[model samples]
Target: MKTKLLIIHSSDELYGSDRILLQVVQALRDTYRITVWLPVDHQDGKHQLYRMLQERAVEVQHMDMPILRRALLTPKGLVRMARLAPQVARKLRSSGADQVYLMTSACLLLAPLARLAGRKKTTLHIQEPWGPREAMLLRQLAKFTQQRIAISQTVARSTGFAADQLSVVHNAVPRLDPANPPKPLELDADCARGPRYLVASRWVRHKGHGTLLKAWSMAGCPGTLYVLGSAPDSANRIDVRGMVAEFVSDTASVKIIGQVANPQDWFDSVDALVLPTDTVEGCGLVALEAFRHGKAAIVSDSGGPAEVVDNGVDGWIFTAGDVPELARIFDRCTASSLAAMGEAGLRKYEEKYTPERFDENMRAEMPGALLGS
Candidate 1:
């Protein structure tokens, strides 16, 4: 019989981290008897991840677990966590699994609880770069997990995991079907004629929507900038539409394509992707998505995206949050240039960021105990 593994995840959305969680299950499903626990189901009916897992015949359960969020840091939240601790501990103890895997840093709070519940072979996957204050607290909590897996070197360093305990596995996405070409987006004649760029990410403050708008305006709105994705129901949300209104005089130059089920369709239509994150991005899975679709990226030198792109080769890397420098890059990029860069990016994607490569790396790096060694 395969070793039983319990995977606890914080969210149920089909975003970057959530996709990686599904990929993790795909990588280990044959080797392990896996049961995934999500903290809650999405009320918005966006249950893509859950459905995908079910399609693979993986058992998934939803429960109210202690997930670390900004709201959970307060005095009231602490009281709630204290209240929930015993209940969560009891659940962990009752889970008849040989190993426990905490899917994201948001699930870090469960580390100590898992340990106390006698789950010695607990692993934590650090998918985000941490700020100093949170890193300090997370480091303390991390001590309880026997193994740590970070998606990128930048994330691994930021989370402060020891070399002995940590493994850096870069993220990858499923390859797009070449036969099923994407349909072109409906745009005005003028907008269609010029180079089109895309910025596909959640409307969060740190995602640099403001900076990108500032730079786009400074560059005289050279081409159509398509902003995809909407802000999650969170305190850190940015009024992306309002920011575009405040920055650009020509409303037609910047189009807000808010929240789509298929971002890859847009990825295929655009010349290049621009990820202007002001803070350290965990892995910038969007860049990989763009690359897989044979598209170039203009990413900030904040974290993992910088490592993925070879500046001036496959893609351009500008200093994070430098408006003038980003403007300069925008002004210089022509359709032909972006197309050539995109070709190089496609090669890089095939060589490094394919799903097969990710699965191989994951299987090789997975803890020996989980592999029945």
Candidate 2:
């Protein structure tokens, strides 16, 4: 009989962690009986993770895992969560899962829930730095399951997890289409107009569009900044559009390509990728995307971005939220330099971030992550 995997994700949005989960499912579906449980209400195929899993014929279920849920903090909400965890645990027991996979610290409750369901072998994937409360909760989770994955070493350090208990797996991207190799970009009609760059991700406060806009103003609009991303499903606080207008000065040109069905096409049109984010950063997956498509990336200095960009080899890393530093990078980078950096980024991509490498790494490093008896 195939070993069953009960994968629990904090949300169904196809953000960084969700994307990694999708890759894992895609890679392991044939090898195991895989089932995904996302902490969300019912979503149609419009949700990227759900749609991708469906397309791959993976069984996807929705169960609102209530750990750290805002509503759960209230009296009535506490009662609801109190009543909910047991029901979810019972359902998990009936599902006959041999192993449980929890993504993000948000799903830390699943570590205990899985044990209640008689699934002793559970793993948690930590993609971002945990806050103080989450860190405390994760410490609690450690007794339940030592099989933890930190997407970058930076994140692993943030967790205070034992070196032996935590494993670092740098996130990987699929190989770009050879037929659609990136060509020379001419985003601006006139060279004097300025360099054109792109920023693609959910416009969350930490993702740093506001910083980019401010830096653009400080640099006197050195180039056009094409903002590409959408409001994520789980995002309730940030008003990105309002923030964009608030940060952008009249002279700056920032285009909002909110969300597109295919952003691969946009890669060929921009000179570089701009990722000026806050300290709450993950392994700069967008930078890997830039590397894949032979585009230079100007990412923030903090967290996983510093690990991704090789300081001036593949791309540049500026002090995050420092408008002057970002402006200086923008002003100093010439067309020839960006082209050179783009080529360097592509070389790094071929060497490290291919789909084959991703599969190989997972197999080598996590042989019994699910299959262990």
Provide C-alpha RMSD values for all models, in order.
2.3, 2.9
Model 2 lDDT tens row, 191-284: 4557778888776777777788888877777777777877756654366668667877744477777877678878767779988887667688
TM-score against native, each model: 0.94, 0.89
Q: What is the lDDT of residue 373 in candidate 1?
A: 20
Off by over 4 Å in 2: 42-45, 178-192, 231-252, 368-373
Estimate, for each residue in 1-373, the C-alpha lDDT of model 1 and write its tens digit.
8989999988887878889998999899878999999876233466777788899899998888878888677998889878889998999899888889999988988989998898878888889998888999999998888888888899988876666668889999988777876767765564554789999988999999999999999998998999999998888999998998898867789989898867878998889999999989988988898889888999999899998999987789999999999999988899899999999999999999998999999898774553112
Q: Considering only N, C-alpha and C atoms within 3 Å, which residue pairs clash in candidate 1?
A: none
| Candidate 1 Cα errors over 4 Å, as ranges | 41-45, 178-181, 186-188, 191-193, 367-373
What's the distance in Å from true for residue 157, model 2? 0.7
lDDT of each: 0.87, 0.78
